[model samples]
Target chain A: MTQRLKTPLKEDDISSLKAGDEIILSGIIYGARDAAHKRIIESINSNQKLPFELKGSVIFYVGPSPVPPGRKSGAVGPTTSARMDSLTEPLLKKGLMGIIGKGDRNNHLRKLMQKYKCIYFIAPGGISAFLASKIKDIKEIAYNDLGPEAVFEIEVKDFPLFVAYDIQGNNIFELALRRE
Target chain B: MKIIKITKIKNQIKKLIKTASFNLPEDITDSIRQACSAEKNNTAKKILELILKNSEIAAKKKIPLCQDCGNVYIDIKIGENICIEKFSFLQDMADEAVAEAYKENYLRKSIVSDPLFDRINTKDNTPAYLSIVPADTLDGLEINVFLKGGGSENCSFLYMLTPSDSADAIISKVLDAVRQNVTKSCPPVIIGIGIGATSSKVTELARKAAFRNLKIRNADDKYKILENSILEKINNTGIGPAGLGGMTTALAVNIEYMPCHMATLPVAVSFACHSLRRASSKILLP
Candidate 1:
């Protein structure tokens, strides 16, 4: 069943989600990747204000292709989530409620999600053309030097995603592993 | 000896790059169709359907098949009787094509100028990685172009086995790797298993095999059988399309082997995700 949800979700909203539930997300979100993650961590360590507020925010790990003329974005698919695992818990602790990417993260990431009342969503990889149309508005937020890796504030409508990790630590990927 | 113009080759490169991004080869599309029909898992079937739809949209609009257009690799096979004219250095011409295509085609520029530090975007996707080979008794130049994303490249592995190891042992290692790391790359993968060579060359062969058309299998009958076996085992793991769980974790397995020393057996596994982007062209001369 396809469930529709608004972004900048609160704890209760994320807690209601369960692994394997499909969703269509609407509202504003942030797009970021490797370089942006590192910069965020550095900002936190140096005791500087984050460029964007993390509370009630969803971080999408995507370094989208350059937006072609007449289109909102180029192929904007999810990157591998595991690559950002090491730098993720801090964001979750800072009230980051959701993450959207592909692939399985580690037990530690699962535990963090459980502790923080967060959810991990898996956007299908390599389906950018369909997903790109969902973006209604966009602006470069930070790390312009990083180009595609730079952060972008984006508003989306009916963006397709599936719940991979839920608040209670259940992971859809782990469930897939067990159905032997 | 016959002559071919460098400008002609550059023009072909531009077309190859655009075609590789816009239109996935028919064999890969057919393989996806076969997997979708064979998949019993509902989630995997849906994922495969979405992938097919994405490709259809990309073809109609001339958009890139994936956002991560990936690093460009050019494999050139030149004939002994072919005389190249116009450009002094072929790599420069190929790089020019890459730059031009990425800009004009609206493809992503994903190349980093440096590896460890100072990770700057190259702006245009220049300095295409090249692999050149010389051919005998051929009359034209052939070029194979492919795009590889970091997600799939991260799952690639290389192993140096002792001479005494059996085929089953190698297969076991590959299965173990797939079970652990296949999700990182998009699933319904085409695995490239290269056996017998130095560490680097073995990996190279694996990459080459991964980019080859799904219609082509290993020439040797023994390797072909092993390829089938590996494909079956990987599918049984239940990774499925997009790793959502199903009977189609891997669509195909291609094994490439070479003659190596008696003391060592090197094996490399390079798998292509569902969007295995590649194209080829030939420059004929008179």
Candidate 2:
């Protein structure tokens, strides 16, 4: 059975999530990929305030297709998360609670996720249209110059993902490897 | 000798790009369906099923298969007897076709004007990498267009093996590359293994091999056997669909080889996710 969780993902919510658990994530989330992450980290290094708050919130690593005539998002799907690994540390340090993307994470970063009581979720890569259908709305929150890589506030309903890393640093990747 | 109008080439390219962006080629779709049935893990099976459904929706609704839509890569082979009429620059025409098609199809503009210094969206994906191959034959143009997503392309690798390296060393290297990077790209991946060439040519061969149709086998029987073996070993890694764990880590392994110097045995590996998008067509010159 899958777990249905909403936004404002608190510490308890993240702690309760186990690696390999399927989840239906709803409510507000922020979407940013490599370019936006770089800019955000630059801003952070400059000691400027972040555009979006991280506390109890979710970050989706995605660069969606252009919004078609009547759609909230176009073919939105997870990107390979490891690309943002270097920039991700600062964000996690600032109370970023959850991340939704695809593929594996570095071991050191998983430890940082645990230190911050955050979780990493994996959405199946390449099924963008199906994933897009679950999103209800999208608003560009920052870095509009980056276009698709810009930070956007997306409201989703029943967005499906797998909890690949939880607060305890139990990684589904390692578990899967061990099973093999 | 015959000629084809520039506008005809432009329109043909535009239509081909639109088709490739939204649809998986028939061979890849069929392969995915077969993988779904063969997948024992329930999660991986579901992921495979979703992939099939996504392709159907992408085609019917006219939405892109993936947001990345990728860098448009075109390979054109023009017969010497065939001439391009009205305009002569194939590269410019390829860019024009790409710009129009991306705008019309709602495909994401993934290209940056500059790789660094000042990164700006080109707005329309322009400047596709077009390689025009020369041939002396009938008056026809053969074009193959590909849309490879960024995630998988970033994981591609090239290695130059020493002359004395044994087959076991080559096998171990292939396996290591798969284990280290397979999860980074979306899987049941289609892997292209290019062997027996200098450094530069082997990478291109690998990129070409990865997108080659699953139904097409390496002509050499030995390479065909090696391809099957590599596929089996990759699946054994159990990276599964999207690396969640299962038996379908790679749907197929395509190999292409070239004759190279005795001292250099370069190998290149490129991966394409399940959204293997490619389209090909022939245009008869006027």
Candidate 3:
């Protein structure tokens, strides 16, 4: 059965999730791609304030196109999550609750998710137009110089996603591939 | 013969760019619809539905089918006997069209100035990968445009094997590559296999094979048999719609082959996701 999750998801809430579970997310999530993730990690290492708080918040790894007239953002879809695996350790340390992207994560990242009591979600890749309909609002937070790679504060409503990784280090992709 | 100015060519290129970007080809849409109906897994079915719906939304709303609009590739077949005022000016005309298309249609500017460094978005999808081929008959130019996204492009593979390698070996490697690349390249993939050629020719044929209608099979009987067999094996993998584990792993498998060197057998595989964006137009001479 499917479940709905609200953002600022607590550590306990994430712990309850498991691989193969379907989720519909609502509330605030931050958008950060490769460049923005690097910048955020640099801030954390220097003991400085991040552009946005990571605790209990969801981070979506996407670089959206420019918004047309009278639109929130253009086709915003999940990029390859594996690319962000290197910066995941520090972000989990800062209490990141969940992540939304496509594709499989490395074993180390899965272990980190379990260790930190977080969950990983997979939004359908290449369905940007449908995904865009779920986004209610968007505001740029930092890295404006990076164009689409800039970090943005996004508010979504009933945004459909699937649980790929849970607190127990279970991976849906691994399970599915193994069954084949 | 009518003299078509460079500006007219520029406009034609611009319109082709927008048309290919905003619209998913009819054959691909039909394939996705059929896959959605046949898909057993509820999750995979749902993902396919979303993809189909997304394409419709993108078309009606005049937005890109995907954010990474991809590099523009133009294939032009020019007739030898056609008289043109300025034959060499076509490349400049196409580049201008790319610049205008990106600015006017709000398409993403994905091209970079250099490959090694200065990895910057040109802010205009300019410097199109244009190829001009001569045709036997005297006629107007025919253009085929393709917008290839980065994700699927990254999954392309080429293998060089000894002539002694059996057909089974080729099938095994291709299947292995697909299994390894499930979600990364997106599922319900259209696979193109180019066999029996040099390394570069194999790669080129692999890409060219993808542009063929998915419903069509290879002309050669042996290759057709191989294509069908491989298609069956791929679907049985159950990678599903978006690798969530389902019945349909691929939409179609197209194979193109050519003569090869005596000692070597080269094979290239190119994959395209559900949103195969390609269009062709023909201009006939009077």
Candidate 4:
């Protein structure tokens, strides 16, 4: 059965989620990709303040297209999550609660999610237009110079996602492989 | 000889890029439809349905099918009887056309100035990967455009196998590649296998095969059978749509082969995700 959850997710909320559980997410989530992740890490290294609140937050790894005329968003789908595996620890260290992207991540990340009580959600890759329809609004929050890779606060309604990894260390990919 | 203006070619390239970004060719759509119907896993079926819906929305609204907009690959086949005005400037013309199309179409500019250091956005997607082929037997010019997404491109593989390797060896290698990479590349993907040739040439062959029309099978019966067998193995892995789990791991497997050195057998595997954005046009003359 599908469940609905709000952003800035808490431990209590995500702990109950098991791998392969479908969910709909509403509320504000942060949009960031490779470049933005690098800069965010640099800021942390330099002891500079983070651009956005990190506690109880979820980051969607995306570099959305230029918003077209008369539209709130352009094609906005998840990018591959594994690319961000090495850079994810700092965010999770600072209370980042969730990540949304496509594909399975490294085993280290799955363990980290379990350690931090975090969750990994997978959005269908390349279904950009239908995914865009879920976005209510988007505002650039930081790193505007990164262009499409800039961090943005995206307000979404009923954004569809699947639980790929949960707090208990269950992984949907492994489960799926076994089922097959 | 017929003379075609450079401006005409550039404009045509621009139009094809825009068309490809928004509309998927019918062969791709039809394959996805078939996969959707054949899918048994509910999650996989639902994902396939959403993919079809996304295609519809993208075409109807003239929005890009994916945010990557993709790095552009253009193949121009020129007939022996055709000559281009300012033929030396063909690459420049194609690059300009890409810049203009990406800007006016509201597509994302994903190209960077450098690969490793000082990675700066080029602002306009330029310097399209363009190739010119001599179509000696043809009567007119044909141009094909493929927009290859970054996610799928990352999944491409190249292997140097012993000359004595069997077909089963190649199939097993491809299966291993797909099993490891398909989740990130987006399945049900089309697998393109290139065997023989030098390493670089084999990779090029694989990319070309990946973008070939899905409706067309390899001309050689042996390669066609190999393609089918590989497809069956990949599907049996049950990677499913979007790699969540299901029966439809791949839509098609296209094999393009050439004679290779007696000492080495080079194999390359390329992937085209379900989107499979490509378009073609021809210039006819009287």
Candidate 5:
């Protein structure tokens, strides 16, 4: 069964999620990739003001293609979450509630997720075109110089995701592997 | 010698890129369908269905199969009797084709100018990884383009083993590699294994094996049996579709081998995500 989630994701929303629960997410989420993560961390470290509020926010690790002529997005899909593992803690520390990406994360990051009460969600990888159809709107919010890797405020409707890790440290990857 | 124009070649390349970007090859789709039926876990089965549906939407809507768009790899085979008209180098022609296709098709420009220090998007997705091979038996130029995304490429592995290592060792190593990195690449991947060349060449062989026609098995009976064995073992790992779990952890395992030094064995493994986007075209020489 699937649950519908509206952002900005709250403590209750994330806490209720379990590993392997399918979710259809709507409302606003932030788009950021490797370069954008670095800048966000640098700003936080320097005590500079961020362009968007991190608290109660969900960040998607992506570098979407240019918008097509008649579409809100062009092949927008989640990148591998493991690449963002090192840069995730600062955002979580600031009350970032959720992350959406593909693949597994490290145990260390899973522990950190539990401590911070953040949920790690996995979107289907390589299904970019289908994912893009769920995107309702997108606007660049910061670091425009990063091109495709820039930060954007994106609105999604019925974005499909599966919870890979929950606050209790339950992991969908391990459960799936041991299912048989 | 017959003369072929660079302009003609570039246009052919652009067509190949467009086709590959929008279409998921039939072999991959068929295998995924087979996996879906064979899947015992509900999560795995659902993921496979979604993959099939996504491909349908991509083709109908003219959307790129993946956002990565990927760094283009083109293997050009030129026949011995052909001469190019005003050709500087193959790379330049291929790059022009890539730039034009990516822009015209709305494919992402994912290439960076440099590897380390000055990481910057090239914007045009130029400088394709081109390998030009002389085709003595061919009557025309054949180009095969493969779009490989970053996630799967990151899972590629290389290992050096003593010559005495048994096939069991190879099997275990492959299982270990997949166990560690399978989910990272996207599950139900096509794995290419190269066992025998020197370190550098082995990976290339693995890449070629990975991207080679999925319908064709290795020519040697020995390697073919080995391929089937590895495939069974991998599926038995129960990593399943999308690593959420099931019986179809990998769609295929292809192994290419060459004779190497007696004292050392070099092995490489390369992966292609389920997308497995590729297209081929031939240029006629007049």
Candidate 6:
């Protein structure tokens, strides 16, 4: 029998997600990629408050295309999560519960996720159109000059994703790719 | 000879970029449809269906086929007899086209100014990887544009093998490379193999091989035969869609070959993920 997660996940709720589990994530997710991550980390190191609280938050590693006429954003899809590995530990320490991105995370990051009870979810790469449908709205929160790389608070409802890395440090990518 | 205005060429290139990004090319879509029907595993079949559906959504709604619109690669084959007033100004015109397309079309500006340090976004996707080839004919130009996404591009590998390396060894190395890099490169990949060439030529041939429509067969009989065999072996790995473990890990394997030094066997593997956004145009300059 398959397990279904309750919607609007809390910090403790992250523990329920496991590698290979399918999830329909709802609520708020902040968008950040490389440039935005560096800024966020700088703010953290400087003992300044982050633009949004990290507690129970899910950060999507995406740099979206510009919004077309009559659209909120264009072609928003997960980028490689491993690019953000350097910035993840601090954010996880601050109570980030989940990350949504494509590709693998390193073992050290997986260990941090385990220690912090966070989950790493993957949306289908290159399925930008499908992924964009799940996004309800987006509001630029900071670094507006960064264009597509700006930080935005995104609202989503039932955004489908699969858990690639779970709270127990199990990585579905590693498990699935291991040579028999 | 009438001189073609740089601005006019720029506009056409911009339109091409937008059209190529918004529309999933028919050949690639058809290939996915065939792969979906032929895929044996239930899970892999479902994933292929989703990919097809995603392509539909991208076309109907005019969304970018993928978030990574990729660095613009424009291969220009200029006619031998055609004359340009300012021959060297072509690159500037192409850069302007890239900027306009990336901005006006809502495409992501993915290019960076420097590779090692100060990794700053160029804001507009300028500095296209432009290659100029002299055309054999007298009256027309041919332009081939490919939006090469980094995910699949990163998975590419080059191997310098001894002449003694058997077909089996080549196949094994290619499979192992894909298997090792599966999660990193988005799955349901199209593998392009270039065999029997110098290192640089192998790399070029691998990319050229990837641009061949999945439905087409290599004219060379040996290469066509090897393409099918390699495709079968890759799918047999069961990496599946998105590396979730299924039978349809590879959609196709296209191979291009060139004569190499007798003692050296260079093989290059290039990967194209499911999106595969590429197109070509031929312009008649009368």
Highest TM-score: which candidate?
4
Better of 5 and 6 by DockQ: 5
lDDT string for model 5 (B154-216, tens) is: 998999999889888889999999998888887889999999979998998999989878799
Docking class of 5: high
In model 3, the Cα lDDT at residue B226 comes to 89
Q: Is candidate 1 or candidate 2 better by DockQ?
A: 2
DockQ (Cα-based) for each candidate = 0.76, 0.83, 0.61, 0.82, 0.81, 0.55
Error of 5 at A123 (Å): 0.9
Clashing pairs in 3: none
lDDT of 1 at A176: 79
Task: Put down candidate 4 lDDT per residue, B192-273, tens digits, no spaces.
Answer: 8899999999999999999888889988898899999999999999788877899988999998889999999999999998
Off by over 4 Å in 5: none
- Please report the interface RMSD of model 3 to 1 decimal: 1.6
Error of 5 at A155 (Å): 0.6
lDDT of 5 at B254: 93
lDDT of 3 by residue, B219-286 (tens): 88999998989888998987877778887778888999999999999999998877777878876765
What does candidate 5 score on TM?
A: 0.98
Question: A33-98, model 5: which lDDT tens digit per residue?
Answer: 898999999999999998789999999988888888988888888888899889999998999999
Error of 3 at B189 (Å): 1.0
Badly placed stretches (over 4 Å) of model 3 are: A177-180, B1-3, B83-85
Task: Give Cα distance to truth, residue B112, candidate 6, Å.
Answer: 1.3
TM-score of chain B of each: 0.97, 0.96, 0.94, 0.98, 0.97, 0.93
Name the best candidate (by lDDT): 4
TM-score of each: 0.98, 0.97, 0.94, 0.98, 0.98, 0.92
Q: Model 4, range A1-180, lDDT digits (tens) per residue?
A: 699999878878987899999999999999999999999999988889898998999999998898888999888999989899999998888899989999888888888888977899999898998888999998888988777889989999999999999888888888988898
Computed on alpha carbons, the lDDT of every model, listed in order, comes to 0.86, 0.87, 0.83, 0.90, 0.89, 0.81
Candidate with the larger lDDT of 4 and 5: 4
Segments in model 4 whose C-alpha atoms lie over 4 Å from true places: none
lDDT of 1 by residue, B1-286 (tens): 7888888888888899999898878998898888888777888888888888888989998778888898899988898788778647788999999999999999888888998899899889888998879987556999889999889999899899999999988999999989888888888788898899888899999998888778988787888899989999998888787677899888899888889988999999997888888989887664
> Cα deviation of A63 in candidate 4 (Å)?
0.5
